[model samples]
Target chain A: MAKQDRAIRTRQTILEAAAVVFERQGYQAATITEILKVAGVTKGALYFHFESKEELALGVFDAQEPPEQVPPQPLKLQELVDTGLWFIHRLRTNLLTRAGVRLSMDQQAHTLDRRGPFLRWREMLLSLLDQARENGELLPHVDTSESADLIMGAFTGIQMVSQTLSDYADLEERYISMQRHVLPSLAVPSVLAALDLSPGRTERITAELAAVQD
Target chain B: MAKQDRAIRTRQTILEAAAVVFERQGYQAATITEILKVAGVTKGALYFHFESKEELALGVFDAQEPPEQVPPQPLKLQELVDTGLWFIHRLRTNLLTRAGVRLSMDQQAHTLDRRGPFLRWREMLLSLLDQARENGELLPHVDTSESADLIMGAFTGIQMVSQTLSDYADLEERYISMQRHVLPSLAVPSVLAALDLSPGRTERITAELAAVQD
Candidate 1:
């Protein structure tokens, strides 16, 4: 059992090290040698876990699954906002999330499953919006699927723009601006009024996640 | 005069050929040799026009100025919608525009000025929204700059999604859906009612531009 636990820990260390390299140099330019150096793991151990650079890239994408500690709210719209805020927070601080996004958007990453992360994000948003509609938090005519696409699309654009304009230093601000412009049209008046679309919401959510993890 | 005209034509040919290669192979992988072959131009001619591949990519970015034939409208909101539709139409048929967008989004093309096109787009949208606000076509609280960012962001996001999901075949429909969800919040009720948010608007705009060109 002790050996098994150490092996899992070694695998995680290697993945995190690879993510840092991928984030800095992108998928094509990133090398396993650098990852091995950063991870301080033997090449044998690295190859034992990940077969190739492509597999490591896929591992980064798989690591992008949203942290499971988002506490639910009675108001589904608030829950939606929390999801966005939580993601922005993670994207700001987490190398793995940043690498996942970078690899997915990398045009030269031909072998990577670039669409998977996008589809998963849309699915997550759709599920939340569906619940919002059922809770009467959404407007009467709101189509959850279309709304999900719009939200995901708008969020992506804002993030990209922020990256280009500010290297994501302004990501939280840009994200709040996106939600403010978009959420009003999808949520009911009361729900819109009750939702917290503050720029500081990411910090609050980050603290909550950290506390839960601790 | 004849020499000057010939030089202009040669430059145009090189740019078109470069766009084709860049669109197919992206910025980094695209070669000057491929562009020269595609253009059927001499190396001297290509070098006379563009000094390097980076210069060629920048030339592509400069060529992305929006078509000048979007006729003025009584309601600025309609004009804004027309601008977006016209872009989608051009993206559907024009190789240069497609290449410009692809290159701008290319993660590995770090030598290129990725933000120039985005800033230009936002500037164009801001000017129109400024007109819309002056004409009272926009809601009182609509901040033109923020709204411009949102419009540009959403348009980019929708185009990218369309590219991934349908190779841009459904871009017009997706763009219209985006406008329908977004414009209602930006435009005043009267202007929103008066605007044409139909999916076929791109076809109509394309026809209009062709007629003007003829």
Candidate 2:
């Protein structure tokens, strides 16, 4: 049991180090030598975990989705908002999330299939929007799949622009503005009125999640 | 004049070949050797025109913005729509624009500055929105800069998503949906009623521009 735990820990350590290098140097510019050096792991051990750089990038791309779900809200629209806000918060605080998103959105990373994350995000958002429609939170004209696509695409672009401009320092602010603009198009006015789209809400939710985890 | 014309043609040939390779293999993976082979040009000739692969990619990136204007509209909101639709049309028809946009949005292309395209698009949109506001086309609650940012980012994301999903086969449809959702937030009812956000508009504008050029 102890040996198994050690192997798992080592894998996590290597993944983390790979994320840092990939984030800094991008996919093509990043080298396994740098990742190995940063990870401080022997060739045999690193190879045991990941076969190649493509596999490492795929690993990092898979980790963008948070392990824990946000606490549910009465309004499905609010749940969607929470999900987006939580991601923005993680993007600001976690290197793993940032790196995963970077790799997923990197059009130049030709070897690895980057579409998985985008399709997964669309599925998650579509499910939430379907629930919102059932709960009568959405505008009558809203289509769940289309809304999902817009939200996913808009979030991807907004975060990208923020990263380019301020390295994500203004990501939360940009996200808030995005929600204010897009929510009206997706949700009814009454539903929009009750939802919290503030930057402080991200902090509060992060605190709550930490408390629960503890 | 004949010598200058030949030189210009050679330069254009090199740029077009570079764009094809860059579009297919991306910036990092593309090579000058491959570009030269494709261009049927000697190394000396290629070097004479461009200093390096980086400069080649920049040249491609700079060519994304069309050299000609879309011909002004009476309502600037219509002008904004036309600009976007025209870009969507070009992204479909022009390999140079595709390669340029691929480089500009390639987050993995770490050497070249990618912000120029995004910022330029934002500046263009903001200028048009300012005009729309002056024409009483925008809603009173709309902030032009925020609207510009949202429009630019959303367009970026929408096209990217389309590119990933269908290789831009459904881009015009997705772009029309985006304008539908976003325009309501920016334009007043009277203005929104008059603007053309249809896929057909792109074809009509292209035809008009071709006739004008001829």
* Model 2 accuracy (lDDT, Cα): 0.84
For candidate 2, write residues A1-214 as lDDT tens digits.
6999999989998999999998777777788899999999999999999999988987887778733479888998888888888888887778788899988877766667788888889899899999999999988998788878888888888877888877888878777887778887888889989999877898888888889889
The C-alpha TM-scores of every prediction are 0.93, 0.91
Q: Which stretches of candidate 1 lie over 4 Å from their true place?
A: A28-40, B1-5, B29-34
**TM (chain A), candidate 1:** 0.91
Kindly give the stretch of ten consecutive residues in candidate 2 chain B with the minimal lDDT sum. B60-69
How high is the lDDT of residue B125 in model 2? 89
Interface RMSD score of each model: 1.8, 1.7
Listed per model, the TM-scores of chain A against the true chain A are 0.91, 0.94
TM-score of 1: 0.93
lDDT of 2 at A67: 36
